[model samples]
Target: MNELRSWPGLEGDAIELRLDNIELFGSMMEIYFRHAARLVYNSDEGVLTLERKSFVNGLTEKRQCRLPRLRSLHVFLDTSSIELFVNDGEETFTARFFPHLDDRTILFGTHGHLHMDIEKWEL
Candidate 1:
């Protein structure tokens, strides 16, 4: 079981990643997007796997990737496409998927005892 931790100082318009009571059980992170915006994550691993589901019609897309010592990740979203950037723009992974704009909640976790700091904003 994973729980959300406590984090303060969010700008009140963006969502901050909370890790006070949350724990991860896998080597992957999960996030839900509700609107058209960008999502980013940073880690030391040279590889990553992404899993996402659309809020409308409950569709899903999955992929596995090998990045270049991923120190950061950036996801740019449009109405029908998603562009993923890794390592401060060192690499890019792009795909197309449909997710509900109204269901903007995102969930993130890791596969092991991985720790991270997460933040989000509405666009």
Candidate 2:
């Protein structure tokens, strides 16, 4: 198993990830944006979830896709929105978000070791 945690947090409007072979038992990945939102990928369940915690009700959205086979992922952030793509464009998910947290810190975690490459961009 392997995990990565952001200590100083990430600052940017766009994020990208490249991962390979995610289909392992108990395998999962998550990205936390301070108290604003979170994106979770559950390889075992073939699910991708986005939760807006800054909302009054903590709104949650989910997408079911074969993530284990996906080798790439991307996230684009706007003033109040998020866009996600998987497998270099095989699938996409988009949503609007309102974050309660003012901090722009970010965190990432994985249940198993992944061949991952990450990048952040300022928009």
Candidate 3:
């Protein structure tokens, strides 16, 4: 099943999460805003994608990196970039983003129920 967890109006430069029973396939996670997504993790393809949409609705092509299957994730966000570390830095993905919206949201989806623990902090 698909699951989405949204955190709006969060002012932070870093985010961390621990997921229990997260399979490498049939799962996806997104960290985004109204205008852009900082990151999208697709387990099935072992890809971590980053994208941005312009103010006029122009969207950038996704940039991808291969990553190992993970149950734990850590993210660092700056004014114009994001850094992702998986499974205690066994793998990593990094990218740049420019978001037009001030509100930020986190969306996590899985084929089945999985327990997740998340935390956010301002840099």
Candidate 1 deviant stretches above 4 angstroms: 1-26, 34-46, 52-61, 117-122
- The number of the candidate with the highest lDDT is 2
- Ranking of candidates on lDDT, top first: 2, 3, 1
True lDDT of residue 80, candidate 1: 58
- Cα lDDT tens digits, model 2, 4-89, are 57744245545443443334335787777654667777777777777774355654655455554556667776557777777778
Candidate 1 lDDT tens digits, 1-123: 245223343223223333222233344444444432223232345456555564566555456566544445565555556566655566666765554544434443334454545554444
Off by over 4 Å in 2: 1-4, 7-9, 13-26, 53-56
Error of 3 at 78 (Å): 2.8
TM-score of each: 0.50, 0.70, 0.62
- Candidate number with greatest TM-score: 2
TM-score of 2: 0.70
The total of clashing pairs for model 3 equals 1
CA lDDT, every model vs. true structure: 0.46, 0.64, 0.60
